[model samples]
Target: MIKRLCFWLRADRLGPDIPITHLMLYFPALMRMICSKRFNGFGEGSEFRPGAYADNCSSITIGKNVAVRPGTMLFAEKGDGVPGRIIIEDDVLLGPGIHFYCPNHSYKDASRPIPEQGYFYKGDIVVRRGAWIGAKSVILSGVEIGEHAVVGAGSIVTKSVEPFTVVAGNPARLIKRLR
Candidate 1:
């Protein structure tokens, strides 16, 4: 009941979409209250900037001191009585326009449209402690971003990144290894 009320309050002002929906996050107190009430776990000192949104918040867990900038979206799928999960560890830095997708569409049937084929839950997405995700980066399902690793802006991560490494570009190839 409380969750529904919070959703209604957010939906009334945010309209259940990205970009515009993120505007409500500008109010720190309101955003904190809403997130605390909605998500499965929301740690202290985490900031959700304006223009950020999360789907299925109850399945998501956010750690302390994580900063999610504006225009970022975190989506977790709940399918077949199983809930998808996303875990953002402590001290993570997320830039603007970043997107995390914890589910993908099934396209096994050639004749049917992708959307009509239903969806697949790929598993949880874990952003390790102190990792930095650049602006506009897309982190796909089942991908674990290693601790202290850096994902370049506009990159598309399809696999788990190595710890203390820098990756960039589509498919997110490793660029440099940090000490």
Candidate 2:
């Protein structure tokens, strides 16, 4: 029954979608326990709020004191005997509805439908220490948010951001340098 036990601890699919009832005051604590079991590394003092979704938890790691807000989705690629594909460093702030996608679907062939093109894997998506990602940001494959950087709300990050900088917009343009 080891497989069943693991599934119960993770609830990988259904757990994230379960809404917390008003009477369930310890819901976050329960989530923390579940994440610690599912994730590669669930850091000390970190919070993984309810409604945060992640599949293939073995490929994701969270550092100390990180906050993954509600509605955040961590879509990491499957572990091919490697891990840390989606790493969130210590002291990072992730806003609500943040989406971290590590796999990109192939669309190079115009002759075929996008779904028929299949999927491709990219490099890691890392959020360095002290970075603040605003609400509804979409961080795509192979992108890294540098230390102390700030991503504004509703931004679509397709590239790596520099340290101590501010980025926003569809492709996440440079707003200014903080350092």
Candidate 3:
């Protein structure tokens, strides 16, 4: 019900502060919004499935036929400064618990303590067209998953995955190239 209200609020069809109970009372309309791929957010023909978690700070630009599965979290840096943009090209499929982080904590300065460094470094995260990220995958900042690549489940992607390749495990070593 909260999701539906959020969608409606984004679409500007309904104002905020509309009681959740009332939205739930109109269950049919709520179902229509949830089931339909066209509502809220900036993505053409992209589907963020129910239970998918996206942060408000995140700026998501998606192309056609993109599917972000349930339990996936997309986080972007916040504040007055511009964070990073998350660009998911067409026909991308993201599985459950896939986390795309756009910001990294600064650890370069020897003089500054970790917590005292305070500044967040950001870099754009791009998942090119037709990439499939499997469940429990973690994609860090400044990395691009090339077109048609497949990331195996539980992989931690800290670097770029070449086009048409399949990668797995921590640090995501390339397992094979897809023909």
Candidate 4:
């Protein structure tokens, strides 16, 4: 049993017999390298297991022990001369398929065409220390999730999350306080 566990943890030895998901589950080192090189441009420590994506902003500061799962997309806008930055502080866990946007459209201008509406607004994303963003959540631009907070799965976080609170659902509402 121990030998089998060891083999799974080593990505180099992992082969076609094991599915990609299984490999990521066991080999954290492989994920770390991928994130550091492929995603986020530059990442630090064992916190992130990365992927392919664009990160041009220096605002994307990540803290130690921050684990961002597979299929997570982080982006800054082209409209904002400077790419919007994201700061994920220490011990934060971002689940799979989590999408974060640092920009938004100006839909308030009803007279403008949809395509033209693209030229609207952009914002920064800040995930404070010890926060947990559940699977498949969409964190909009300019939203700050406070320390030790929990965001529920499939939640669309549009506003700032309070510290030590649990929020869920679209446009995320407060579910309860974390004890």
Candidate 5:
């Protein structure tokens, strides 16, 4: 009953296709409450800044003290009736314009257009505890960003990053390994 009411209120206030859903970024308590009700698992003190977009909130799990900056997009691909999961562990810091894609499209058939080929589920994306993903970084499917790892700004993470390491550049090469 309350869930339906909240949904109706949101739909009425924000309309159907607003780019930014939650408007109260400055109000942490309200934001936390709203996100906790929507997401799969939203831990305490986790905040989603204004303009953060989640394609399917039910597939995204946010941990405690995680800060997702504005313009971050969390997209969980739905395949075989199961949506891809994005698990962001505790104390992670996500910069603006960060993108996490849990599934990729199949383009094996050259004859068909890329869009026509359709998509496939790669796997869940896990950002381990204390990891920091920099601004505009793109994290591809089936990648596990290890604990305390730092992904540099504008990097494209194609593979699993090692724990306590710093990665940068296109394809995200390991720049340094922290203690």
Candidate 6:
């Protein structure tokens, strides 16, 4: 069991895997130790709970005092050799089942299979300071969620949200302004 645990503890191997999930739950400090170097920025006072999945963490920068709940997935796609950045600023609140996807698969060619075509990455996903993202929200590529903004549950954010605003629904229309 020690050997198996050691294998999963490697920097590149940590993710939504069950063993890692248990480790993060039972020994969060251990998870922090491994992730501190792997992530571009894993801030102080931040918590990545059990069942939170991330790929290309080297491209992810998380700020101070952020709370990422269970079932959240952070996929930071790399273009060329440089990874596409996913920046989550300080004091942010992410609810369960939130998914941040930075890569969009290309399907321009109708003749060829989509998988064979290739993939393209959008720009960085920036979640500014003090924002609250509700459960099951999907923040797509090239989107900027402004400071102190609130995203309602199950919202699919396609465009950049303005500061202090509340957005919801499939296309994530502006519901109200908080500021």
Instruction: Please report the candidate that would top lDDT against the real structure.
Output: 6
Per-residue alpha-carbon lDDT of candidate 1 for residues 1-179, written as tens digits (9 for 90 to 100): 77766656654122245333455556777767867876777789987666677777788889999877767888876454356888999999888999988878889999999878777876789999999999999998899999999999999999999999999999899999998
Worst 10 residues of 2 by lDDT: 14-23
The candidate 6 region of ten consecutive residues with least summed lDDT is 9-18
TM-scores for all candidates: the values are: 0.85, 0.85, 0.72, 0.71, 0.86, 0.89
lDDT of 6 by residue, 1-179 (tens): 88776766654534567476567667879767656876889999887787788777788988999877888998887443446779999999998999998877789999999878777776889999999999999998899999999999999999999999999999999999996
Task: Give the residue spans of candidate 3 off by over 4 A.
Answer: 1-45, 78-81, 109-113, 119-122
Q: On lDDT, who's better, 2 or 4?
A: 2
* Best model number under TM-score: 6
lDDT of 3: 0.70
lDDT of 5 at 72: 87
Say which prediction, candidate 3 or candidate 4, comes out ahead on lDDT.
Answer: 3
lDDT of 3 by residue, 28-131 (tens): 45533442422334455555555565543236666787766666777654323455667788889888889988776667789988766655644678999899
Check candidate 3 and list the clashing pairs: none
Give all candidate RMSDs, comma-separated: 3.7, 3.5, 5.8, 8.9, 3.8, 2.3
Go through the candidates in order and give each one's C-alpha lDDT.
Answer: 0.81, 0.80, 0.70, 0.69, 0.81, 0.84
TM-score of 2: 0.85
Regions of model 2 farther than 4 Å from truth: 1-6, 10-29, 78-84
Error of 6 at 94 (Å): 0.3
Residue-level lDDT tens digits of model 5 in 75-110? 876453458888999999898999988868788999
Q: On residues 2-29, what C-alpha lDDT tens digit does candidate 2 reach at each position?
A: 7765655555432344443111237767
Across 9-66, the per-residue lDDT of candidate 4 in tens digits comes to 4432122333433445568776555345433433466444334233442446667776
